[model samples]
Target: VKSLEDFYDMEGFRDKEFDKDDKGTWVVSSKIAIQKDDSSPLVSKNIYLFFNKNNNKATGKFVLSKIYEDFSKNTENEYRIAYSNNKIELLDNAPKEVELFLKDYKFLVEEKSFKSLNNLPKISSRHNDNLPLYSINYLIKQDNEINKWLQQKYKFMKQDAIMNIENSGELSNSSLSNFYFKVRYKGKKEEIQYFRESINFKPSKGGY
Candidate 1:
């Protein structure tokens, strides 16, 4: 069985320095299981490796993003994560070696009523026109390819597997749960092996 380390190696992540010439930014996200407070249940917290070009070298910082909690109680408590301004070098074409010390994230949430009393109004509307157009199309095409492969392998009727995937939220060990596993396993094994060696796969625990 493949582990999370294997998944990261397969993804081919590079330092933000080589990513874009104009934007000069790149971000990769991952989720880890953790408890928010003593009384709260464990939830997957989102973390990001954010990199941006700083002069000739790329600097990176580990950011602790927010989590979706208290959903059953119909309250969204915003978490404020604080981190130092310290950053590490992760430049492109440089020796892949760096040490970074991540401080423990501090979570803070103020009362909802307190915000309104202070004259801070929430902004609800956002401009969707600026969103990337290709991402939705790409996911749709991938889903179609996966569904096509599944139907051919299992003799599933049209739209049957698609329905199962949509309705199978958080159901582990089922067809929907194993969707990611299927994506990696769908391609030809020999071709994947050849490609993997070309990229120089080295498993490291840094930046994760």
Candidate 2:
């Protein structure tokens, strides 16, 4: 999670500027969402500030950087400035005071449920043809080993799960309709349960 002040503090941000159209509406600027390294996972999120020629304050509409892409359109009369990953989205009809208030506000990571299995038996008879009958103690150790392996695998899947949540925009428990864990022995998917928290853009008046 990062704040708008943090965003502005990044190198080259202060120099970024907005471009306007013939009709006086701001055009999407190249300054929006600068990806300097191109190889870096982090990208700059940009908010185009449009203003009246007669007034230094906003004229109304503005354009924001889009999620998963590069651009989105909005108006001050119809939207507020907010961050989502390396992009921005509209917040319906937000006031200037609210926008200013949020200028330094940081985005908090939103948490979602992540599920995988635990306590699975290793070398199940269903899969292994070998009949090396094991003692209860050995079986327990095998189960523990299997669980450890699953945890390692699940860690790799965390990024993908977070990406899915971002793309879908559905954070409800019911919306978590995917699995990343499986048990080879029983041919059954492992049931997992955990929570994922990632920085997400949303309109807020401060407290959770």
Candidate 3:
């Protein structure tokens, strides 16, 4: 298996150029470009795929680092994937995984089954100081309610509640500590919340 360092140093990975100080945690671009009207524009996009080297897991922090509408004008537009931890959320559409889940398990859950849970309250605070104090009661209750509804409707085996936790490194300044969620269907053996200390969430009104 390739190491994380190898992945980071892979060919075609170029450091992103941004004006702001917050240049993202990790970013890289491709050398390919699209051409238009006698000019070779930087039309090709750069995608940053973040993964856990130790656990060999992927995260939702994938970003389109650079985009160009015209080669003559250096108008680079960056687009981000609507993210949760395990899911790649869309801007105006539901997540592809969620949609697949609905389609495959139509016998298990309806397409609109989770519509109500969609309105559940999200983590509103951006500071870790408020997480412990901030109530997850409503969120848990809502999830449980959905689980119960699914059980009643489909009579499928109900599994233990599984949650995604971001794990950070021991050193505060280590860039490798930037970890996100990994999905495991079996049990909560590795479900310990890791970076709950540094993370601050701004929950969306709808899906996040």
Per-residue lDDT tens digits for candidate 3, residues 1-208, read 1222233222221123322332132321112122332323323332233432233332332222223344345554333433233333333344453344323222111122335534554433232443222223223232365445444543322553332334332323333323332111222332111101122111121122
Full-model lDDT for every candidate: 0.26, 0.27, 0.30
Which pairs of residues collide in model 3? Answer: none
Candidate 1 segments exceeding 4 Å error: 1-23, 34-42, 54-70, 74-101, 104-208
Question: What local lDDT score does residue 34 receive in model 1, on the 0 to 100 scale?
Answer: 36
Sliding window of 10 residues with minimal summed lDDT for model 2: 7-16
| Cα distance off (Å), candidate 1, residue 8 | 18
| Segments in model 2 whose C-alpha atoms lie over 4 Å from true places | 1-44, 60-78, 81-102, 105-208
For each of the candidates, give the backbone clash count.
0, 9, 0
| Candidates 2 and 3, the one with greater TM-score | 3
Residue-level error in angstroms, candidate 1, position 20: 9.2
TM-score of each: 0.22, 0.18, 0.22
